[model samples]
Target: MDKVIFSFLGTTLDAGYSAGRWERWRPTIALCQQEDMIVNRLVLFHGGGHDSLLKLVIEDIHRISPETVVEPVRLQIRDPWNFVDVYSALHDFVRRYPFNTEDFEYLVHITTGTHVAQICLFLLIEARYFPAKIVQTSPPRNSKRVDKSEVAIIDLDLSQYNQLASRFDEERKEDVSFLKFGIATQNSRFNATIAEIEQVALRSSTPILLTGPTGTGKSFLARRIYELKRAKHQFHGEFIDVNCATLRGDGAMSALFGHVKGSFTGALQARGGYLKAAEDGLLFLDEIGELGLDEQAMLLKAIEEKRFFPVGSDKEVSSQFQLIAGTHRDLSQDVKDGRFREDLFARINTWLYSLPGLKDRREDIEPNLDFELERIADQLGKKVRFNSDAKKSYLQYAMAGTTEWAGNFRDLSGSLLRMATLANSGRIDEDNVSVEIQRLKARHQTINSDLGVDESGNSHQDWLELRDRIDPFDQVQLAYVIKVCKQSANLSDAGRNLFQQSRKDKKMSNDADRLRKYLSKFELSFSQVKEW
Candidate 1:
């Protein structure tokens, strides 16, 4: 690093005022000297301070750099403050004592207050007396006099600063690849769907509405649209996702259209609201039906007119965002009930695409399973493979209609993650599969019982009584048994099917035992139940 000449131009009040707190300046002065920068002179622009404290700072600087000259200039200013005069005085001092290039490689103008700093910087920039670098130095907020001069420096590289500003402006451009669906699919199936989604995205500029059951990758589809649009240069914006359920009443309006300073009790600064921030990008409103009527009205107007007023402002700000909304609810029913706005519903309904539930897409199960397993493996930082027996067990369980995947893709992903975590010897086996299956079945049964549904799909009078009698372990065992019995329609044939499904020689005995236990629980022997 080249030797730099640093100048301190700010008041004691700017450094923060308290009794005996002036000692903090010593460490800061010492830091400047220790750097490749040489301190040729120390100028103290004093506002109001005891002469003893000023002497202490000067003496400390002298001890660190003996050849350094100290010049103390007393400033006469107003009591409360006049910012214009303060800026003029600082500007005058810099012009009068012009820095010689040979004596200083760089000039560092340090300030404590943002207002004072901004004024001083503006003056310097206007006069072309700007330093090679402007550094903001301030004491840590919480500390005693013992640890005073802990400073944080922010280097304002004009080029990099401009780049960051540009990035903020271009923040709406999003990479959709980061958003992935949890379902596993075969290579052929995955590629085909992605290609179709890309085609739809390319052809349409209408608001895309993704409708599906919860956890069926509605959000993922929205992100894919954003990605496809970005890739095709259809829109140079980013994807801003907002779960409408989280934004309630005043929060919803304030979040969508920001408030001005002092608009509300806690409104500190005028912020660019989400709509403004998402300029020209895709705004993903998840659970759109959950938005309050007032907010829905405002959102509808913005979507139709491309403008909205901030919470406190009268001026309508322009918003040129692509609207992508997702919902699990039947909005048409909501409209009929007068809960959701019919007008807003019509706007989003323009280009709606409903996603099929995972259960409806059994063909995708195998591929999605593999994809989720790979994802889980990557997350756990481990390498795992599904053993043939484990894979078969998983397929049978998945293909069975007993387990209703209420959470859809998300539930499948979680199940795979748990299996990945518990896999032994880097391979998931039938025992682990059985254990996971039983656990999931137990959880689902509890949930179903709470919803007052019995095992045979009948409404129970006492759901609690039904729940007590139903064993999740037995349910899982019976589901496997039912799958085998349905496949062969004979006890001996079902046992053979169970053995084939097990994929392990040791598992054959366990399979036979499980089969018998499953039959006993149903209160029927193989001969009585079997059609063959």
Candidate 2:
């Protein structure tokens, strides 16, 4: 490959009056005479009015190294010591220069420019404007003639070294861990998504939307992103988190947009809204889909303009804060249904991310359990550990396909809190876990039954006749069970899923037989009902 060097003319080092110049080495010309490195081309940059000097250096370079080609670029720099001027000049030169890395190995000579120029060169090189290592030349040893000046090449690529590479890799892992609340989650997709969230949190100041089902860590992740940005000194104002679901009516407007004194009957004093309170910081609007149409419209205006009028006030207040919104609602659908504003959705949808629920991320349950236990230890002021049998039993049930984690992480945390509080001598034995499992089953069953009031409008003559056969009280539950059956792969699968919790207590191991017996009472069979 052809060797090319970019260097600035050393006004003092390259100055020579006679043949004695061969005794002293100039960096711009010294790099060309090296035994191992060939200067196939030299692009020299210098301030104006150095035509004579440029002439002498080109002729000298050719005399000693006849094969080297010299190209002179006259730089327009009023002060080489000024960072802005020197950087602009060099930047323009690099921008216009034709760089063909495949055909040539290029080197930037940092030994010739002023300190400011050297720093600018390093910055541009580090940013990868043009790919090249830096060449630094110095005078030779005392006994050796200056003509034999030493040359050192420094490559800025850090990944070539194992230590530096590993350090950066480990730091990135830590950032991802921080976003996950330090849980050692094993889900590949979840881990990769968290890594991307960390990057976006640190790099972008625009709004971020985190969507997931309730208790799926949407709010938690939003706060973690805020903290990460705060730690990086991205913003200094206080973090203001408001759950829009709890807000309602004009009060919602006043709470978010503040109210001037005497704005309303209850407006005893003027208040600075959350937006103004979050100046230069992060404002997390959790459950943002709960905001009314008017509130959403005003919020969109505030987000885009950074200015909003207070209640009953004409003057507008300005705030510069980053926004991170969290919601369990499908906002796109909400937009279509006229429940949410499309323009507002469009503004915040750019960096949207969906967090998987605990049911969807069953592989992470164990680590999250571990994390909860650590928190329990802190909260209750006593360390707790589950015995071998208890942990095995709980994990089996928790990770089972039949288990429905409708409440997501909130359910797990509450369950852990109860068990830890009820532990015997800081140990949760098998019996303790057994009782907790039964309690959890009843809890989930009650919730499921409450939701079984069949509004699904399943109206068929056979179904109506079958429904009339059962008690009015049993119709809701029977209908829900049938729905589950229809959605399942087969009778056994449906029964196994439906009776998973109750199966823990029954002595008989046959879920299918139990389901069949119940169905017989209703004069229905899985094969016949599944078709309906």
Candidate 3:
């Protein structure tokens, strides 16, 4: 069966009764001739006063085609200029209308309504309150005769447009690249994470928590998200980024919630603060874990109420700002430790993302290296290039088992900066590569010197890395054995000292044998730790 065509009747002089009678110069009548397919029903919405004109319209529609049923819906709307009344009436009509898409298709006539009514109809259909296609009616250009001959059906769904879809895809890609600062990253996990962040940023204004080690770009990512939202017309105010760790004592409160003049000794002038500055925009609080308990309480209120009072002020100011928090500390652990507010953590924990450290995403190192080189060229106003040998040598040492990127991307960035600065004549050769490698090794070795490890330098320096290589029980016991060996003179002496307390329980008391076997569990010996 064909679907019903729903439309609003505009009671203008042309559509109204003229000369004390009906006129065949109606748009609905002319609408019938332009149709290629049969219309099951024509539902017209009109005011109670337009009953006579509606009867004429129905008669004309029937005269054109007896197959089409005309249904006139009586609504009590006195003023079409009152958008609320007209929209509410139409909304109620649509809600009460029996919509069965399986049995009948639907079409909404965008024409033949007041301008306000037309806008309401468009909004309702776009919101899916009316699941129907749009049909527009046009009268004859001469204005003397009615003509629905110029009619058009517009499809709202844009997926049908191939070129438009391609354009949208390209826009999304550019947004992702902007977030990465045009790094052209290669890590699959990292790429997927960026895409997810973009979607959340575009659609929501909830508090987002970015947790990662220092120098993982949490602050940078938050700023990019703000820019993306601003570009999409989601926000308009300035992006207020605060390093919460730097806020101290009364300064924290004064900086975040503002302060009235003369609130404190140094209060020279009244300030609007970060929240007000970020009104209808984004508030990025980096190192959120460092915020004091009082600050956290005030921040929670600002987020929940969108209103807060500044220091020494009774008047409440409003700021409906979006929040993004960055942290290196485990907030849940802080909550348990009584250092962070539990409620604040719970509120902002809805959208949490843990950015991976550089060591964890070694696959992206090559591309990042190239990105840094370009960044250096941009910064110095002169391009620099690494000789083939230098590039290959740096990559080898960077990816070696000995390398521990404890500081993650920040460390890599600094290393590149140093190498670029020391490059002779804008070119990094083998000499430059050799110097950087030695410096990195010296730094890493100095940091790890205190950790008990192989004196022969044959094993990985970090004992934490061996946690996966052995059983939990063996790992603990092996660490203790290594510690004892470091303090003792020789293997027998270290073994004897370790078993001094528990040796009485043994049947055959061969202390060295027992210690040897225990050490062997971790593939270690007294010589390794003692020599170190």
Q: Say which candidate scores most in lDDT.
A: 2
Q: Model 3 segments beyond 4 Å from truth?
A: 19-26, 47-56, 74-92, 140-148, 449-532
Lowest summed lDDT window (length 10), candidate 2: 451-460
lDDT of 3 at 8: 76
Cα error, residue 199 of model 3, in Å, equals: 1.0
> Which sequence of candidate numbers ranks them by lDDT, best first?
2, 3, 1
- For model 2, residues 176-198, the per-residue Cα lDDT tens digits are 88899888899888898899989
Give the TM-score comparing model 1 with the true structure, all chains together. 0.52
Model 1, 218: alpha-carbon shift in Å?
0.5
TM-score ranking of the models: 3, 2, 1
Q: Which stretches of candidate 2 lie over 4 Å from their true place?
A: 9-36, 47-69, 75-91, 114-116, 139-145, 230-237, 251-272, 301-320, 453-532
With a 3 Å backbone cut-off (N, CA, C), the pairs that clash in candidate 1 are 172-237, 172-238, 173-237, 173-238, 183-368, 184-367, 184-368, 185-367, 185-368
Best by TM-score: 3
lDDT of 1 by residue, 384-481 (tens): 77899889998889878766888888988888888889988888888889999998898788887788554345343432343356688755455455
**CA displacement after TM-score superposition, residue 362 of candidate 3 (Å):** 0.8
